[model samples]
Target: MKNTPSTQGRAYSRRDFLKLSGLTALSIGGMTVLTACGPSTETKDSGATDAKSDTASSFGEGGKLRVGMEVAYPPYNWQTSEATDDTIPVEGLDGAYADGIDIFVAKKVAAAFGLEAVAVKLAWSGLIEALNAGQIDCIIAGMTPTDERKQSIDFSDPYFIGHYGLLVKKDSPYASATSFADFAGASVLGQKDTLLDTVIDEIDGVNHMTPVDSVPAQLSHVNQGACDAITYNVENRGGLLAANPDLVAIQFDGSYQLFPDEVSCNVGLKKGQDDVLKKVNDAIAAMGADDSTWETIIARQPA
Candidate 1:
């Protein structure tokens, strides 16, 4: 299989693609429960030492921290064959698969705790279930620590901060819209089960659009006049705009709103995995002290 960039402009090696598709098939063939209910606790610290010890013991022999992520997300995780000095292969992904900033950070955490870092690619909606079932030790998929997610699992301190933005056609009237409320009557959509979908509801009288199956598909919808715009993280929006010159990214200006500072993206662990959570949190804190580390990681990928 050849390593090629995805239609979305992210590199995806053929090996990585086959591996991901195979895993999905295996999961379905076994009738594996792909989705499950998650907790809603907003402020539980489960990444303590005891939890880590327990998780380590559960995984047996080698102290490997199995991490689940969506390898398709660039600047965080993506597929690439031309291994650069910084590219690291995802554990289960094949054909020179590697990840971005988040994977780099996960590597630091794994090293700090003397554990092998293993990456597992899973759908965003199924991440929590995978963690709870021990399919993966933790989730490092750039998932935001939200109040709704806290009930199902615990999260480490935020490692990277980002906010949402709207992606629209360059010449679209909505291109100049700033706030979430600005799209009052415009049709908007986002990835299913993501904050983007739920966040749109905050806008009064907005014509909420149905969620799409993937980021590329959502963008396609906007391109085909199926939707006015799609909302997503600024980092991803940058990648999208870079890949597709016709799309315009609408920055929130001062209108961008996140769930306060407390709710940020972090590594997620199962409810009882306190020890593992603490190890990850401490590693993140250490990483935070070095601004250059993040700068270098960000500079390696497209946009």
Candidate 2:
């Protein structure tokens, strides 16, 4: 694991999911800043036929690194209507582009593999299936690789290390909370199929509501008083607060306990693809070696 550049917000890690799962080309001289659809849940088919049909000799034009993401996770990844010096036009989707830390990371991996980077928009629940079916090459969306996820697909070295936190209305009673226990008996929102959903159980008496698809939806629930708070990556706290100033991010300190495997995010790859894995890991290691570069990329995002 590498040390992630610190932002104005506190970063905490999400506990491991036993599962796995951005962009832009704002040039920092040699880099570009840039920027999913899918089922609501993982299906058994995994589109294996599609993966077989799309097999290529190696990772750009011959076989661009088809990366899948939800494009709804801001600060990590998000969709934009226009392509700019800071965004990449999504493949197979018109009038849409992407930007954020994930995009920067994807481009680095693609460049390392000597391939082109193509953004594939897939539903968060469907990302794994897309990868298994070959709808995309890999998943770089702030996904944490756990033992369970490793059984289905391989994960490269972690590119981003983060922790989970909650987003609540600034004026809400929970705003000054110092621990998950503070939200006890309170309604909480999280994305479907994500570790955040399961982590809510740690809140003791929390009212874990049904999960939703996007951050916007989760935040909406919080804003509307449908829920008192929502779980998210601590790295995204700054972004969340920036996007919704009315909301405050609560990250626990000594009062919170995170297991060892809980909070690291890594690159996800198809099973038995060590060749591609090495390339991505190498890229990640190289990127980690230069903290300034990572900080520059992080600074580019609004959050």
Candidate 3:
């Protein structure tokens, strides 16, 4: 049976029920009890219906691929209602929906595999945990493949490469400083537990401010003169710069020792799901070698 719009949105399936029954049997013997109490004609009909439902609910049968992401991040993921017939509402974001680089790219990747794209909103830090828990099949959030994360999950080929930058107030002296060393005596802030925060700590004489809860908060501290600047990726900083006129991005050319040139961000999957990982990676590679996929996703955002 073809998946209609209504059926596509719901998460019910006969296969899922069967899997549930099997698991229930192992834990509670519920299936055995139901079978013993269901020898009637009605039971047989119900069983057949359930079996057909399970077969229809299989992932590949409906041509759907489940993807998880943090819709709060812009340029990568965000909500919109403009609906050019190109975007769809996320599974559980209420009136909000996700679009942008990640969603667009995810749609393309899903299409390449003959799968329908379904977006599942997830917290940034919880993405990996959700993947391992089977809550999500893959994470298309704009996540960097850090060494720490590599130990738990496998990442796809780098689809986008971004550089780090400093966001500061328009009038701050450090606004014009291009190199990390130039902030030797200035106060800096960044999102807590992120690469930006760690990198800022390496600057000599730099009074690093307490880590902020979010990127916007880090930008707010700089705007309020709480810190000289906030270190973050150019993509995120770009959004802040566009939203706050008083903020300026200080691009460090070759001055601030390059952190790493090939910081490739890609989809993440649960470890040992090599088959699914290979399919996703191959889809990314076949879409074209150009980074326009990233640009296209980013272009859908406000800035």
Candidate maximizing lDDT: 2
Candidate 1 residue lDDT tens string, 1-303 = 111111221122223322322212311111101111111111112231122324433541268777777666655665555455565555543544555767777778878878767666666777887677666778887787666777898877766655555778988888787665677789988788667677667566768888975566677788887888787665443346555678776655433222122124577888876776777767876664333454354445542
- What is the Å distance of residue 228 in model 1 from its true position? 0.3
Predicted candidate 3 versus true structure: per-residue lDDT over 1-303, tens digit per residue: 111111211122323322222212212111110111111101111112222322333333456666776565556666564455556567644555567667766887788778877776655666776666565667887776677788989877756555455667888887777666778889988776456677675567889788875566776687788888777665444345556779776755632223433234688887887787778777776655343344344444543
Worst 10 residues of 3 by lDDT: 29-38
Model 2 gets an lDDT of 0.63
Instruction: Write the candidate numbers in order of decreasing TM-score.
Output: 2, 1, 3
lDDT of 2 by residue, 1-303 (tens): 212332212122122211111112222222111222321212123233354655633333465878877665655777766577666667766777777668888888888877777777777777887777766788988776655677888877666665566778989998878765677778888887777776677677878899986666787788788889887765444445656668765645632223222455677888888777877777877764234444455555532
Q: What local distance difference test score does each model get? A: 0.59, 0.63, 0.58
Clashes of each: 15, 39, 5
In order of appearance, the predictions have TM-scores of 0.73, 0.75, 0.72
- Against the true structure, candidate 3 reaches a TM-score of 0.72
TM-score winner between 1 and 2, please give it. Answer: 2
**Candidate maximizing TM-score:** 2
